[model samples]
Target: MVKQERAARTRRALIQAAAEVFAEVGFVPASLGAISKRAGVSNGALHFHFASKAMLAEAIETEAAETVRRLTEAARARHGDSLQAVVDATHDLMGTLAKDIVVRGGFELAGDIARRTKSPLRKEWQRWIEDSLRRAGHSGELADQVPWADAARVIVAATVGLAVLGVKDATWLSRQNVTRFWELLLPRLTGRRDTGTLVSAGSRPPAAVPAPARSPRTPPAH
Candidate 1:
């Protein structure tokens, strides 16, 4: 049992270290030795957990994909089929790109021509956006003029563009940037009246809210 726990820890450390290295250097230039050293694990230990750099990259991508899944799920849970869920999720994803090394590395790897086919992170994100848009259409949240496919394309393109640009300029991933994007686009996508209800800055996640705030305290009887 102890050995299993230790192995899990080592594997997690290697994945995180590999993500940091990959985020700093392109996948082609990233080295297992560097990952191992950053992880503070011997090369043998890294090899014991992962056989190759590609495998380690795969681990990073898988972990990143899982994180995105949970983020989208939480957003949907909060907003149901509202387009706001899509907006919130996009904001969360960009925030993740800015601060989460594994997610950033996974996205970068997803764009690498040599290894792009191996990573599903980008494709999965696009699919989720499409699915969310479709749901919004079904819920009558989408504007009459906007087709789900077109909306999905615009959103996916913008978000992916931001992620790519963020590689060189961290400012692209800032919440303000994402919020500004939604502020401009949501009005067009949902029309003027519906747009008023959506929060372009994205809604706060349920978990982030204080427990005491769930129900307001009643003042003493007047």
Candidate 2:
């Protein structure tokens, strides 16, 4: 049991290290030796866990997908009542990617993986975003008259493009700028104005009550 746990830990470290190196240095320039050194693991250990660089790249993609899934799930749980839940979830999802070097690398690696392997991470991300939009009542004909699926695809594509740009040119596509871009885009997509109110999809009332004041109590004599 202990051995299995240690192996799992080592694998995770290797994945994280590889992701960092890939993000810092583009996949074409990255090396397995660098990844092993970053992870503080022997080359043989890394090979044992991941057969080749291609496999390691795939693992990074899988990790990115899993991260997006978890962030979406958390947003759903936290803001279940609001259509903004989808927006909030998307923000959280992007936030995770922006912070993780692995996710950044995965975006760059995706094209190569698609050409070389049958992995469907990009498609999965698009489907997930589309489903979220549908659930948020942003489906069907809006003012723009564009189909929801098409819009969702555009959003995903734009997001991926921005992410790649951000990785390559951090000065041009900083996290703050990316967030503000999304903030502007979301309202337009949902056909809603930024009213700055907590939109609840459920029947629950908003939490508007003020807290009770504390009574003054006599202090004990010192």
Candidate 3:
């Protein structure tokens, strides 16, 4: 039992370390040696956990997918004000993307052609957004003039853009940035009655201003 527990810890350490490296340099340039170094584990330990970098990336992708799945599920289960729940959940995910190396690495690595199919986190996010929008429209949370699918497309595309932009400029994930996006979007998307209750961004003080856009001449990492 002790050995099993130790092995689990080693594998988790390697996955986390690999996520950090992969998030920084992407799948092609990342190396097992670099991941092992970051993990504070020996090469032998890394090999014991994962056969190759591809396997490591798959592991990261799986973990990231699970994280998103839980977030979306919890959002949907909120049971009141579906749109507000969706908005809060999206805000939660942006914060997670800002802070979680595994989640960010999964997104970056999943975009790689060389990587094998793992859990499709991006597609999952898209589905969740569309479904949430549909739920809102059905619940009459959206104005009659708004089309759920069309609005969902705009929001999902914008969110994905933010995730990509955030890779270079973390400010893209900032509360103000997200709030500004919602501030502009909510007016168009939500019913006038629902506007006052929905939170556009996190609870962070609105004073910590967002950063300006930066060129992506350097490889992006979150």
Candidate 4:
């Protein structure tokens, strides 16, 4: 049992270390030596746990996808019926992508891997997004018009593009702008405009205005 526990901890450390290295140097440029050094483990240990860099990359992709799946599921469970929930969930997903450099980098790596190799993780992510969209009431003729598969593709592609842009120009895709882009585009794709006035990029809606108080009536006092 102790051995198993130690192994699990080592594995976790390696994964965290790999995520950091990949985020910094990218999947292709990052080497096993750097990952092992980051994890404070021997190169042999990394090789023992993961056969090759491709395997490690796959693991990172799996971790990222699982993280997204959990967040999406939780959001749906909390706010499935409301359109705001859908919008909020989408924004939340983007926020996750933006905040976690490893997750963002892993997605780019997964795309590159898909082009060169048979990457099941990439396909899984695509399917998961499509499934989430369908569950969120984006379907039928509207689904046909937008096509959940195509919509998922566009959503992920846009995310990747935005992430790359942000990496190049830190201010290129601010969180506010990302939120607004989704708020505006989602309604068009879902054929639902439940959220009131789309908030502009970098600006939130103004606080609700209070009603004016009525004037007091004059009294006939001596």
Error of 2 at 216 (Å): 50
Please give, for residues 87-156, the per-residue lDDT of candidate 3 as tens digits: 7666777877887777888777766666656447888888888888888889888899999999889988
Candidate 2: pairs in clash = 81-201
Compared with the true structure, the alpha-carbon lDDT of candidate 4 equals 0.59
Q: Best TM-score goes to which candidate?
A: 1
List pairs with backbone clashes in candidate 3: none
> How far off is residue 218 in model 2, in Å?
57
Candidate 2, residue 89: the lDDT equals 53
Off by over 4 Å in 4: 81-83, 113-115, 118-125, 135-153, 164-174, 190-193, 197-222
lDDT of 2 at 160: 66
lDDT of 2 by residue, 144-189 (tens): 5445666677677776677667666654344455456656665566
- Clashes within 3 Å, all models in order: 0, 1, 0, 0
TM-score of each: 0.89, 0.72, 0.84, 0.69
Report the lDDT tens digits of candidate 4 across residue range 1-222. 866656666676676678767766667788899988877778887887899987887777777776666655665566554334344444555565656644665656655643376545446555656666665444342333666666667766775566556543545456676776776675666565433433323122322112222222221111
lDDT of 1: 0.81
lDDT of 2 at 41: 78
Global fold similarity of model 3 (TM-score)? 0.84
Off-target runs (Cα >4 Å) in candidate 1 are 116-118, 205-222
